[model samples]
Target: MNQTKKYLVVGLGRSGVSAAEALLRYGAEVSVYDKKTQDEIEAPLVNYLKTQQVTCYLGTDPSDLGRYDAIVVSPGVPLDLPFLQKAKTLDVEIIGELELAYRLGKGNYIAITGTNGKTTTTTLVGEIFKNAKRKTAVVGNIGIAVTSTALVAQDDSWLVTECSSFQLETTEKFHPVVCALLNITPDHLDRHKTLENYAKAKAKVFKNQTEKDFFVVNYDDPVAYHLIQECRSTIIPFSRKSILEKGVFVKDNRIIVKDQSQNEIDICGVDELVIPGQHNLENALAACGIAYFCGISAEMISKTLREFQGVEHRLEFCAEVGGVRFVNDSKGTNPDASIKAIEAMKGNIVLIAGGYDKNSKFDEFIQAFDGKVKALVLLGATAPKIRETAERFGYQTIFDEKDMGECVKRSFSLAEPGDTVLLSPACASWDMYSSYEQRGKHFKSCVQELER
Candidate 1:
């Protein structure tokens, strides 16, 4: 038997639980701790962990840091926490679930990170690779613990990971052969404390990369575009507007990819993509660049681009009731994301927004919503804040009901046949719904109920 070492796993969320399970599978003695009591965690996972015989610490002080070889932290746990700080002082190697997965996986990984469009880009890149018949897995911040997947998988396969700033905060030697920074915006300001700090966390994706690695970035986003000059890896860039010397871009309705020597490959046409929105087109361009780096064929890239239905909660069309289209964009959890969603609309919009504020500044949304949104229905914890900001910007804002159902009804009442009722709240959903998916599902349900 391999020597049984002890491991401490902190946080019982998806990533943390996955990490603990992986450690148990590796023949390590695992002890899991969560801030919530045993009763507070999802009943199924808690019961499952008990069956696995993992020692548990529920609703206990996290000061017991001296008993483990390493600490496996979930993304939700901050590195600067009192217990975590003490663990570091006691010489325990603190690592995230992503780091754990990368160490154990047998495949060459392609990592994607940005404030927005990361999930779409990561999933698209993985799809492009899979369409080429490559053995690939998409995991990380989006879903599935990268560390857990890595333990069971070979390192030679392609691991397309959707890394977030929280996961990036604890990463050390976890390097990727193909890395991308999609774009940077003011997001997760509450956790990162400031815009600069949040951006700095995102930039860490390429921190330990080498010359053999390729760093692909968006040259259109000023924050992300300018950071390319400081990266040490061979740079590949994608743009919807700017001309890249090497990488991917659109020209004359065709999506073009150029090699380091300026050789070109026409992947697809701009109008060929199934998913709408300028940001998604940029996402496609970036994913195409990653596919090219991973040796995926242009033909496969084109096919996937044309066939992809897009990820849910990202401008997903719910229904068209009496000429009014309902869109569930509950994934728009920040000001920039909401602004982009609003900008994507063609006709007047009845925009339903606001949730847990996350300390977001509203100037951008105010500027973007100038004449786009016909009316605003604000709800959740940040509804008052959103209303205040909208009123301060000289726009008509409605202080509406408690949940998404009521908001949807109000939006339908305010909208006409040609207008749109969009639930693209520019804040986190924890204040009302359990997650963005729940919020989106409620919107879809309300729309369905209306249809009947």
Candidate 2:
């Protein structure tokens, strides 16, 4: 990257702010823009940007983008916006935060993307690398912006980044040495408008990889499997069912990997995993494949798997109140993710679900209930829609609450002694909270407040 380059960073979100900081650190001039007003923006961020001498355009779009060498867009900003279209006409390079990080960072990257399980898989891979005593940073959609650590990354460092469709959509040359796609399900339909467009965006992770690079895909997911045909990277697959001739799978209750020589290596038994659910087993398999390719020993992979409990907000056990377990799966913000959460439950479930409606259908989620969901406690903007869907499925035990506290109480009331109260909202948390982490924390607080 040229030090004299001028960058226009659109969006004052975490990723955008990080990009501006990174650009300034690289000795480049940067101008930050956000649709939000100066007062609406956080005080700390505003003060920090001012200190860095970055130009700020708040509550409005910049009159001209041609002055900058390139425009860095945050994941939340839509590409179809009029200003972005104008930037395109100006022939100004428009790239995402991830792309900016890639352009400036020095390291081998292992990027994971899917509608679900990206965080768990990325974190697991990061743990494996760290356990091997490798320098690693887990970033992207998992929380920390990649730009935060990109400048400090060494050639030997491993960046386990969780790429989202939103980030992937704007990537042009953001390549990873190792990339994995957990599964592709209907999600972010409001943004992409179609599953094809969404999958295309996800496929961008491998768009710049060569044959020397590795792409780990989920063999069990048809969408993920189908994408293999378009990848130029060496394809490595992981499956929950069926043994593969040259990939990772479960055999005889053990996690097995088939090397390039067609030799079978047993990593560990499925029971050894600290994380619950068949979905996590798939995640473990993907992590194993990535670790194996990265030269991480099976023992290290098994050790990480055995000790890794799981990522927060994804089937995290909050507290057992009145003999009923309260599980917070607030990260299950989509139907497919919620389906996996529901399937992972053992006892009868009192499910607290529904949030911002992403125009997603509830038929599949309701079908997965399978008599295990004792009662459905709906909330948020999509409560009525989910209730209507449940009724159509002949499910009568459904309740709706206006807030998280009431929803938790309602679920607890519906649960029996041996039952589980799961807060697995099958929609995004934007309707009620800033992020899923916030929603998950509030749920935990509510559960902790339950009278013993």
Candidate 3:
């Protein structure tokens, strides 16, 4: 945080802009770069940066890269880019936005990372800390930029951050007082390229932590359980199945936590949670474990668990039309996430699946269909790929839809009374929609139209 240090922020995204602003605020010379041209960037942000006197490099490689002391990279920028590779050779000291926030921010941090339940767990932990009267800020992949929040963070502030594999990749000294790896599954394979590499990136959340720090991990997930061997922090394992001598687990339908002191405390009943799904129960456990390590009381954690309705786009209830219920699980952008959504439902399901293929295989997703998925309504680039997988399983009830509206309508037609029409695309929404939120909203609108 030296006043005269020069910093280069790569990418003009939210994280990039926030990093640049934070560096400038700390009295550092800042330069911004993005692949997009000046016309492609937002006017307000462009004008705002101008007022700060930060140099902007658009549609080209940053000039005089060797002059900067450090380069802060946004999560979306690929590390293998030729310019970045060249920068690495020059020993420019590349770090991610999370690392930048960590270096400049003063606060206790609780970071959560996983393939499926990061947002739900991070949000739950944030709520639990707030319920305990702690000054908490929820940031990172959940939405808010950590750099922006970190700038104003007081000494007593708790930064509950949701870290993704991409963000974790470039981190070096980004340690959290409390960290959790909810569950590791095959996701972002197109980016990380391999499962081992992805898990290693996620394991970075605990890389800098000492024995004084606490690390929460999923005992149920073999991939996550394996990471325990690599972590340096005090391990707290959470499981939906089996009793644990340490960490959080469920017993006789109640959430139980066995602290570091060997004192077991009953947090809440499984029935008390407003959110459905065993996966959510696991999320709740991970959140509770984090909160417990942070000194939040069990009563406060339980209260938050019982009242928190769950995050949007994760098995969110859309509406009921003609006795068929519609659920939006657009957040299930990966096979494992969609599998959890399918397992959470009660009645027969007319599943609307498929989207932009991330080079992921769908055999496991197709196998999960079993008896619950009465009919499959497919769409987007992955439709044909999913159909092939479904046929391999000898499951034949399938409908190919051209759009989200039609996908919903087709799912409804295939659904009977007491059946659930679930929009749990096992792929990302980028094929047709900008994000999963937009896709979920459009699905809700289509369902609402059916009600009319």
Candidate 4:
């Protein structure tokens, strides 16, 4: 915390607000910038910042940037933007909220990152740690800003964090005690420009880890397995397809952990996991691997994994109306994730799909429907794009709606008594709602409004 430093916080999201607030507390001059106007951002927050003597640049881009020591960018803000690029050319340092938090906060971090399964894994790990009676806070891309918890975190506090590629991009010294890369599928190509770039960004999660730190990875995912080639930390690979010599994996229907000394501990049976889908099995393995390495007992890990009902918005069952089940999977923000949701569902589905266009291809997503999807209800910017792909796949049952409520209604209408209406949009919720949580909540609200 430097009193003489000045920081320009970019984007008016939670990360931006926390960064600015933390900087102000450090006696640094803080400024916040958001393209959304004060009204759009809500006046209460804007007024509060003003009362704190913080400068705010909302509605438009501010011209001056060379004066600030660095720009703390929120994850949603693209670094390649001309505004940020100009800062780079001016020799001004640019860092993300994760980096800033790492510098300002004190804690032993356990970061989980991947295209999908981050929320489930991070949440499950947090639960396991809780059962072990550790002082813990689960934060980061899952929802709670890391900076918010990090600012007040003690040196021994366990910050169980869910990370995204965007948040990992600007990290310099953001090292975690135990870093897990669950899986790296193609996602966020719009901002990253390419799959390789996105993977490189995710790779940053453990870039600063020392030899004593542990790196947990999904051995079943070739991409995640590939990442271990450059890992400096001790490797802890978890797999669903293979039994590992010294990590976490399934053996004869039970989850087992093998330590460096070749000693094995049986965590639990594969059937014990309350969460469905092979993807979730991978998540369990990853979580178990994380917990075991952190010295959490096998009994605690097993108990937590079995009791976990899975994260909300990830294949969460809302209700059965008129014998039709409604499942909310709004967290399936990418094709790979939606594919997992599809695999996890039973019976025919009236699938609600499409959202913000992330420059992602939907061929695999459409193909995953596999005659299981009776009808596809589309919404948001990617509706047309996904429809085109569905047509290309020779799958014709499709409908387009303007929003989440309409999409949920259309999905229910398309569904039969025995069918499931699943809200598993294959794109981000940004195009229609601020976030996937909001989108999920709207879907649940709309489902509740449906008559018997």
What is residue 177's positional error in candidate 2, in angstroms? Answer: 0.8
Report the number of the highest-TM-score candidate: 2
Q: Which stretch of 10 consecutive residues in model 1 shows the poorest summed lDDT?
A: 147-156
Q: Candidate 1 on 1-452: residue-level lDDT in tens? A: 24387788989888887888778778888888888997788888888888888888898855568877889888988778788889888999898888877765567878899988988898888888888888788889777678766776764678899999999987887888889999999888888998788878888788888888899999888898788767899888899997778889998889999997778899888888888889889899999988898778888889999999888899999999999999989999898888888888889999999898799988778779868788888888888888887788788756578777888889999899999999999898988887888888988999999988
RMSD of each: 1.7, 1.1, 1.4, 1.3
Q: Which has the better TM-score: candidate 3, or candidate 4? A: 4
TM-score of the candidate numbered 4? 0.97
Number of the candidate with higher TM-score, 1 or 4 = 4
List TM-scores for all candidates, in order.
Answer: 0.96, 0.98, 0.97, 0.97
Q: 1 or 2: which has the higher lDDT?
A: 2
Clashes of each: 8, 0, 0, 0
The lDDT leader among the candidates is: 2
The residue-by-residue lDDT of candidate 4 on 1-452, one tens digit each, is 66989889998888888888888888898888998888788878988999998888887886788998999999999888888999999999999988998998899999999999999999999999988999999999998998899989998899999999989999988999999999988899889998889899999998999899999998888987898888899999998889888999889999999999999999999998899999999999999889999999989998998899998999999999989999999999999999999999888999998889999999999999988999999888998999999999899998988877788778877888999999999899887798999999999999998954
lDDT tens readout by residue for model 2, 1-452: 78999999999878988999899988999999999999998898999889988889999888768888999999988899998899899999999999999999888889999999999999999999999999999999998999998889999998999999999998998989999999999998988999999999999999999999999999999988999999999999999898998899999999999988998999999998989999999999999999999899888988899999898999998888789999999999999999999999997999999899888998999999999998999889999999999999899998878898998888887788999999999999999999999999999988877864
Residue 6 lDDT in candidate 4? 86
Model with the higher lDDT, candidate 3 or 4: 3
The 10-residue segment with the lowest total lDDT in model 2: 443-452
Off by over 4 Å in 1: 1-3, 42-44, 51-53
TM-score of 3: 0.97
Higher-ranked by lDDT: 1 or 3: 3
Candidates 2 and 3: which is better by lDDT? 2
